[model samples]
Target: MVAPMGYLPQLMYGALITLGVALSAVLFGAAFGLLGAMAKLSASRPLRAVAEAYTIVVRGTPDLIIILIVFFGGTIALTRLFGRTVEVSEFGAGVASLAFVFGAYATEIFRGAIRAVPVGQIEAARALSLPAPILFLRIVLPQAWRVALPAFGNQSIILLKQTSLISVVGLEELMRSASMAAGATREPFKWYLAAACLYLVMTGLSTILLRLAERRANLGYERR
Candidate 1:
């Protein structure tokens, strides 16, 4: 059975919020992931150590625990350090929490991609006396992005689904909105099914996009 007509607006609005949060997190996460990947591959020991530590801590913890720490513990930590009142929006906290988690996974994907780049190519660039930035920009990043696409796409889809965890912090995404509707209408089955279908729709679209990206990235590598 479908959700009541009255719940349509709420469900749509919640979906929009979910999309917004996922986008924000993914953007920041990509940036952080790139930086982390570079750091992990850097010659500097301290940089590598820091990058590894960050990945270890994030991957070692549960995502829901991270969200709670960011939403609740973050406030306490910030207030103490800043010596002033600090408040973060539930949406912002959700975005930040998910971004950090997403970034950790993305870092591994990017690092692997970077490693897959032929060392000889980098050596060739160095022999030609190309600046490091130029070598990376003109040669390294293109191939790395292609190599990373599948893993990045996977992370993106995971992050999108993970947005549901934000509801615990009281940001009214699809799950929270559906829960409220179910409570109000006393029809848990319908609203919950609606939420599940909405999530499946999002996942389906992401799957299609990822497949397209993979095909595009692998075009040059296809054998005749």
Candidate 2:
């Protein structure tokens, strides 16, 4: 049992919040990615261009810049729209920015995964006269899910670490909490070390879960 001291409890709470934010961002990002991937793969030229522009811009920019943009830009936009002062909270801004970045990468991941699906299967499905929706739900999505899992897991882990950046906006996630505690206690190394350990624990757990998921996703492949 660890000795109770110096805002460890608060830091733990903050870590939980960090996890929640990362997860929420990933969920939202996945939705954005699915649409973006569809647009990229679609026959429509304008949609493909729009999706191309989104990925290129987002991928080229730094995550920190994006965070700042979402944080300050959202507040400004909201205030202008409402004709009054509007403050965007750190949590909302952080999640939205992170989701935006994550979606850009995820769009590529999903697109690649979809492309990786065996073309022969799609031809067979068409030959069988399966509706496009049914074909995707029954066949394409499962293989894409498997192919995308490894990349998705890596992206999730990166997003988890990036949660620390939210500290700059004053969200009381682990990094911010540790910074405050370290300052108050004048023990920067100790508090920051604790924060690092907590992050490692979270990432380690995520890695393990991801491996398990990968194994499950590969079960059919193994059997064959």
Candidate 3:
């Protein structure tokens, strides 16, 4: 089958958009994840409850619904606050929606990692009179990262694939662009196969990076 001649450039553009959105979402999501984890472990009951509620609600809903609600609802809230009509860019909405979803799932990963840190270690830190900040920085966080890495990597991969859903909002992601190419060329199979190959490349590279991180993190640990 003759490949669609001009589809390559458009597919490349969509690939860049997908990567850009995922990268932004991951950075912001990490901040939300850390705070959510800290609140989950907080002494204040209200704070813990609020964090729990956030995770439960987000996880319970389908990702498509969450994206639509956050996108449309966010636009309405922003318009009311600013008292001016402003159009929300599809790219911006996609980033915020995906980031919110990613953060909710990351809360679980973070909370588990924090719990995995040995209680004895925290007790020893308290016995040594280490301040909260010092203890978290020097003792708790490093160990938590080691425990959290595998889950975090899985979440990262999920988020990357979730970028495809942004096409529903007409964000011109890889899938959307491929669809457009197929329509113009009247060759759906050719364009879709190209899109799949691009996705495979992105995911394969991510897997390699994750493996490297796992190796470095497990350094000096006793092999089972």
lDDT of each: 0.91, 0.95, 0.90
TM-score against native, each model: 0.93, 0.95, 0.95
The C-alpha stretches of model 3 lying farther than 4 A from their native spots are 1-3
> How large is the C-alpha RMSD of every model relative to the true structure?
2.4, 2.6, 2.1
Q: In model 1, which regions exceed 4 Å deviation? A: 1-3
- lDDT tens string, model 2, 115-145? 9999999999999999999999899999999
Instruction: Give the backbone clash total of model 2.
Output: 0
Shift in Å, residue 138, candidate 2:
1.6
lDDT of 3 by residue, 1-224 (tens): 43578778989999999999989998888888899999999999999999999999999989988888777888898899899976678899899988888899888898999999999999999999999999999999899999999989889989999999988888998989999999988889998999999988998998899989999999999889
How far in Å is the alpha carbon of 92 misplaced in model 2? 0.7
Candidate 1 lowest-lDDT run of ten: 1-10
**Better candidate by TM-score, 1 or 2:** 2
Instruction: Compare candidates 1 and 3 on TM-score and give the better one.
Output: 3
Candidate 1 per-residue C-alpha lDDT over 25-98 given as tens digits, one digit per residue, 9 for 90 to 100: 99999988999999999999999999999999999999999999999888888889899878778998999999
- How much is the lDDT of residue 160 in candidate 2? 99
Q: With candidate 3 superimposed using the best TM-score fit, by how many Å does residue 10's alpha carbon deviate from the native?
A: 1.0
